[model samples]
Target: MPTSSRSSEGGTRRAAAAALLTPGLLALGVSFVVPLVWLARMSLNRTVGPAELQPDVSLSSYVDVLTDGFMWEVAWHTLWLGVLVTVLAVAVSYPIALFLARTRSRLRGLLMALAIAPLLTSSVVRTFGWLILLSDDGIVNSALSTLGIIGEPLTLTNNVTGVVIALVEIMMPYAILAMIAGFGRVSKDLEDAAGSLGAGRLRCFVRITFPLSLPGVLTGALMVFVLTVSAFITPRLMGGGRVFVIATEIYDQATTTLDWPRASALAVLLLLLFGVFLVLYQRLFRMVEGR
Candidate 1:
């Protein structure tokens, strides 16, 4: 073909690709970019009253959120909660994922179904179930007391511990599914070769299996971290107003105080903080993988 004809074909293909992507780009702008711009504008406004916001632009809200010691405490709490939930979810899911990956039992399908059954239920229902289980007179306390673990029912509900437990349960299935996919990609031949070379099961797993599965583990951890940090429902229900995280604070500011500007400011801060953490994490992971 002539160079002119090839160039024309390339231009046509580019035009067609751009045309096909236009609708998706427009939808993304409408759904995400527009709201983000509006949110940034709102965050700059001044709140004059409980239900009133002035059009005048200011940084008072940002200053208040950033400088306030209480806001810092809440941010710290949210951060640690996210970290704890991610750790627990990853720890709990890894073994289950390994089992699913290696099992040839006839009940594999049933086990997989059981593992993911929680996700099929509404989050509200799951949290409520945890509420009952962790309540003073609930099964956990009853069993612990029966085992002489404590004289009285320990305070499980309406606290950080309860929140952690519930969040772990919520994130476990996602971590497991991600790891299962990751484990599936790993070749069994490498593990067998290690065993044939006199490596113990644990040694083989530590040296061969675990490193190969790091991508899945990292993905699950990041997902759980993001979800836990941004979670409103689990914290609200499990914490029972005593435990205050950034999401709950934002909710209170927006709804109860009707301070949209302050809420928007808090949201903006949260997004920036999360973005920074994510970038740092990805860099660290890349560094580790490079080694």
Candidate 2:
């Protein structure tokens, strides 16, 4: 082919790729970039009163958010929620994901659906359901009492414990799906070969299968952590307003107090936290791939 023709073809392909990407880029800008920029600008403004803001630009909002002990507590609560829920969800989903990944039964599809069935319901509905279940006199406490597992009803609601439990359930399906994808690359043949070499089931799983599935585990953990950090519904309902998180704080600042600048500052902090985690995730991914 002539050099000019080759160059022309390359340019055409580049143009086609750029055209295809334009809509997605535009959507992303409208949905994410523009709002982020707006928030950053808003964060720099001064809050004059509820539902009122001043046009003056300053770092007072960010300074207040950073210096406020309450803000730190909320941030701690948010991080704690994210870590607990992510750990619990990933732990609970691991075996289920492994079973689904290895199973050859006719009901595999049904089983997979069942595993993820909770996702079909709205989070609000599910959170309400949790409210019923975790209430002091609710089914969980009643069952525990009846079974003699406890002498009295546990204080499960309006606390971090209840929120963690509910968030774990809400986040499990995501963790399971990520793990299932991770397990796809973990070959059963490797396990069988290890067994043939006189490795016990647990040994084979620990030495061979687990390492291969770490990518999924890491992916699921990262995803659940991020979701949990930003989650509002389950925490609000299950925590019964006793648990204050960054999300709830932001909501209250934005809506109740109408302190848009403060709310925007908190949001920017949350975004920074997410960026830090993403950087850590990339590093971890590199390490995993290196191994």
Candidate 3:
């Protein structure tokens, strides 16, 4: 083909791509950008009374949220929960993901379905189910007592422990899926070659498999962390009013206390927190990719 024809074709493809992307971009702007802008503006406004917002621009809301010790505690708790959930999810999902990635068993499809079946149910329903299972007199405690593993029923619900347990279960599927995708880049041939060179299974995995899988692990961790931080339902139900993370804090301010400005400020801070982590994730991802 002539250069002119090739250039024209390239330009046409570019135009078509842009045309296809326009709708999505516009939708994102309208749904996400507009609300974010409004929220930022709302955060600057003053709150006069219950459900009453003043039109004046001020940083008092942000200042107040920053100075509030309880808010700081909530923020710390949210971050801590994010970290804990991400760690546990990754730990629990890694072996499952590896098995799914490498196994050629006949039951692989069934096993994968079982692993992800929880996702098909409503989170509210799953959370309620957890409530039943983790309660003091629930099946878990009864079974543990039957096995003589414990002499007493454990306090699992209405606390951080219950929230952690539920969040780990909720986030594991996401981590597993991410890791499976990452493990796609790791070839069995590489492991075989390492073995041929006298590398033991454990050593080969530690040096080769795990390193290659970091991308997937990191991706899953980031996803779980973000989701865990913003999670409201599981935490709210599991915490039983004992746990107060950012999401719950925001809900209480916006609906219960009717303080829109404070809620908006908390929201803005959450966004900023997300931004910082995203930046760090990008840098670490680049380093892992050797870019």
Candidate 4:
């Protein structure tokens, strides 16, 4: 086709694409934007309980959520949990992922099955399992006591450590999956090429494999962080309701306390905190990926 004809066709295609996207844009606004706007408004409104949702707009909820030291502490606790879980999950799962990546077929399938089973289990059920294993008299303590490893059981339930472990268990599958995908994307030929050129395995990984898999690392870490930050059941159950995360707090405000405004304000704060990650992605990952 001639240059002019090509340009015209491209323009027409763009116009048609825009037209097709309008409905989706509208749906997005309705589904996400509308509730978000409602949430913002609710954040400003005064809420006595679930029943008393008045339109008397104010910042008391924001003030309350912000001024409370407990919320800040809870937020910090959740943040640390997310960071630790992300790091540990990635660190622990990478080797497994690499192993699976290298394995031919059947073993890879088995590893994949093991990695995915935890994810397939319900969160409540998983948390319950942790509770059984981590409680003072549970399997861990019984095993230790039987083995004479220690005189008594250690405290794992209703603690940060327990919560972190549960979160990590639940989130590690995603990390492994991410790493496996990442490793699949990396060409083994590159490692072979490096090896042929006198580069050792460690050197090959450092020089070639690590950098290429970073995108998957970024992706997996982000997914784990976001999920852990907003996680409700595992934290609540494993942490013994002492684990106060944004998601749990939101639940309490809206469901238990019947305080929608405060909940909405807390929700908005969660959104803002979550949005920081988008900023981080733009600044950090885009630079890494040369986007």
Q: Which stretches of candidate 1 lie over 4 Å from their true place?
A: 1-23, 104-110
Per-residue lDDT value at 240 in model 3: 99
Q: Note the residue pairs that clash in candidate 1.
A: none
Stretches of candidate 3 above 4 Å error? 1-7
Against the reference, the lDDT scores of all candidates come to 0.90, 0.91, 0.92, 0.85
Q: What tens-digit string does per-residue lDDT give for candidate 3 at 1-291? A: 699999999999999999999999999999999999999999999998878889878999999999999999999999999999999999999999989988999999999998888889888898899999999999999999999999999999999999999999998888888788777667899999999999999999998888888888888889889999999999999999999999999999999999999999999999999999999988988887673
Candidate 1 lowest-lDDT run of ten: 282-291
**Best to worst by lDDT, what's the order?**
3, 2, 1, 4
Q: For every candidate structure, what is the RMSD over all alpha carbons to the true structure, in angstroms? A: 2.3, 1.5, 1.7, 3.2
lDDT of 2 at 88: 91
Q: Number of clashes in every candidate structure? A: 0, 0, 0, 0
Error of 4 at 241 (Å): 1.9
Alpha-carbon deviation at 51 in model 4, angstroms = 6.3
For model 1, residues 188-278, the per-residue Cα lDDT tens digits are 8999999999999899988988887787788778878888999999999999989899999999999999999999999999999889878
- Give the clashing pairs for model 2: none
TM-scores of the candidates are 0.90, 0.95, 0.95, 0.85
Better of 1 and 3 by lDDT: 3
Whose lDDT is higher: candidate 2's or candidate 4's? Answer: 2
